[model samples]
Target: MLIGYARVSTLEQNEDLQVDALKAAGCDRWYVDHASGAKASRPQLDKMFELLREGDVLVVWKLDRLGRSVQNLIELINRLHKMGVGFKSLTEQMDTTTPGGTLVFNVYASMAQFERDLIRERTNAGLRAARERGRVGGRPSKLTHDDEVMIRQLYESRTVTVRQIADRFSVSRGTIYRAIEAGGVAQTEN
Candidate 1:
């Protein structure tokens, strides 16, 4: 069975072109999405993945329609391969079911990996440069040490609820829980 997957970045885009192409390529059935490929969560994609079985080939109108990044593409292909399924890109004219197609796909996967490595190297170098210049990255903490200490005191003393503390600090309940876990203290004294 040739299972098709199609997508458009926004609701304004039409699926007719991709659907037509997939139908022309002999797709027996399809899953379509009206969302960005950058989004990790897609209901139709997840549904299609669950419906796929061994010997079925997953087809897409284009590579970008199926994947947003090399790492993500390779990961999905690896999963499909493990399930004894094949992958095909109509525009790229590449398939993983044949030896020649498999070679080409392998080359593509390698190039994606190389691109990913280059990105990582660049990011690391930028971080190192920032460190040398006495700068740090990452978001600033939402709560101060005193706020955490007060949170611990309030919780242990049963004076305030987790929700109350989170609201007061403008953080989530999970942050308070993590702080308590990391601090390893149940109470505090003034």
Candidate 2:
């Protein structure tokens, strides 16, 4: 059984072309969605998943209609393969039921992985360069050095509770604790 799935990014867009293609491909049943591929939720796509069986082949008008990205496409295809099902894309002429199709899909998967690795490497290198220039990432500290010293003094005096100190500093109890710890370390170093 060839079960088809089609999608349009907006309600204004028509899925007639996709429907016609699926019908030509001899789809036994079909589902359609009017949501963007980037969306995580698609009611019709979920419904199609429920209807798919082990021997069923999931057919789509185009590969982009099925997934938002190459990684997403590979994941969906891999899932279908694991369920003992097959996949076919009309526009790309990709069919996972054949050896040649499987090879092509594997190459696509490898390319996606290579792209991801390159992105990670570039990001790490950028961070390293920033650090070398004395630039740190993450949110700036909410409390000042004077505030930390005052928090430490108030904490050691035992005249006020940690919660009271936190309220006075407009920070969390954990922040107050860290400030006290930092002040203690600074004093020891001095």
Candidate 3:
């Protein structure tokens, strides 16, 4: 049984092209996903996987129609293969049931891995560059060293409220509380 999966990235994009190709390829049943956006769920894809059996083959008009990322594609294909089902891509002429097709799939998996490696390497290099340039990746402190000393002085004097200190520094009362705690200053309701 050939079960076809059709997808469109957004609600605005129609699945007609994929549906026509899948129907032409003699798909017995169709699973359509009008994905719309990144956060949207694909109930049809999940239902199709659940309906697939040992002898069932999953077909797609294009490789990317099944997955947005290579890692995701490889995982899905591997899962289908383990379940004794085959996969075929209409446009790419890839069929996992044949030896040559298996080789092509392996090549694709390798390419996906290569792409992942490149991304990781680039990210690590960028982080190292940022570190060398002395740019740390967290929020800047609201209080400078001079401000810290003044906070300690004003807080110890107990002449002003924490809310007052917070207002003076344009920060939240929690920030004032945190500064006091960090400096091991005794906390009291102000």
Candidate 4:
């Protein structure tokens, strides 16, 4: 059985092309999802995976239709292979059931890995450059140590509720609560 999976990033996008291709390729069953590839969760894909059985083949219009990252695509392929299921990509002409297809899969896998490494290297370089310029990265701390101490004192005195204290410190109530939670006995002393 050849099962097809199709995905598009937006709800408004059409799955016609993918669906037609899958059907033309003789897919026994098809699953479609309209969701961002960046997200890990996809209900339709999960269901399709559950329905998969040994000797079944999974087909897709392209690689990105299956996963956002090369590592993720490779992982999914490996898992399906271990389950005695096969994989086929129309655009890439890759079918994991034959030696020729396996060779193509490996070649694609190598390219994907290379692409990931290049992205990582560029990101690291960018971060290093930003650090050298003294441009601090990440969110600024909501409060300094002294501010936390004062917040604890105010909490202990019962002068203000958590929300009121958060407003006073220009932080979230959760932040104030976390500070109190982390302070332990020190908060009560304050």
Instruction: In candidate 2, list every pair of residues with a backbone clash.
Output: none
Which stretch of 10 consecutive residues in model 2 shows the poorest summed lDDT? 181-190
In candidate 1, what are the lDDT values of residues 1-190, reduced to their tens digit? 9999999989999999999999999999999999999999888999999999999999999988988777788888889999999999999998999999899989988998888899999999999999999998988888888887887777777777778878888889888887776678653422
TM-score of 1: 0.75
List RMSD in Å for every model shown.
3.8, 4.9, 5.0, 3.7
lDDT of 3 by residue, 1-190 (tens): 9999998877898999899999999999999998842422588988998999998999999988897677888988999999999999999999998999999999999998999999999999998999999988769998997888788788999999999999999999998888888888989999
TM-score per prediction, in order, is: 0.75, 0.78, 0.71, 0.73
Collision pairs in model 4: none
- Model 4 CA lDDT for position 119: 93
lDDT tens digits, residue span 56-144, model 4: 99999998999878888998998899999999999988999999998988898899889989999999999999999998788877889
Candidate 1's C-alpha lDDT?
A: 0.88
Candidate 3 deviant stretches above 4 angstroms: 37-40, 139-190
The Cα local distance difference test for each model comes to: 0.88, 0.90, 0.90, 0.90
How far in Å is the alpha carbon of 7 misplaced in model 2? 0.8
Query: Which is the better candidate, 2 or 4, if ranked by TM-score?
Result: 2
Task: Give the runs in model 1 whose Cα sits over 4 Å from its true position.
Answer: 141-190
Worst 10 residues of 3 by lDDT: 34-43
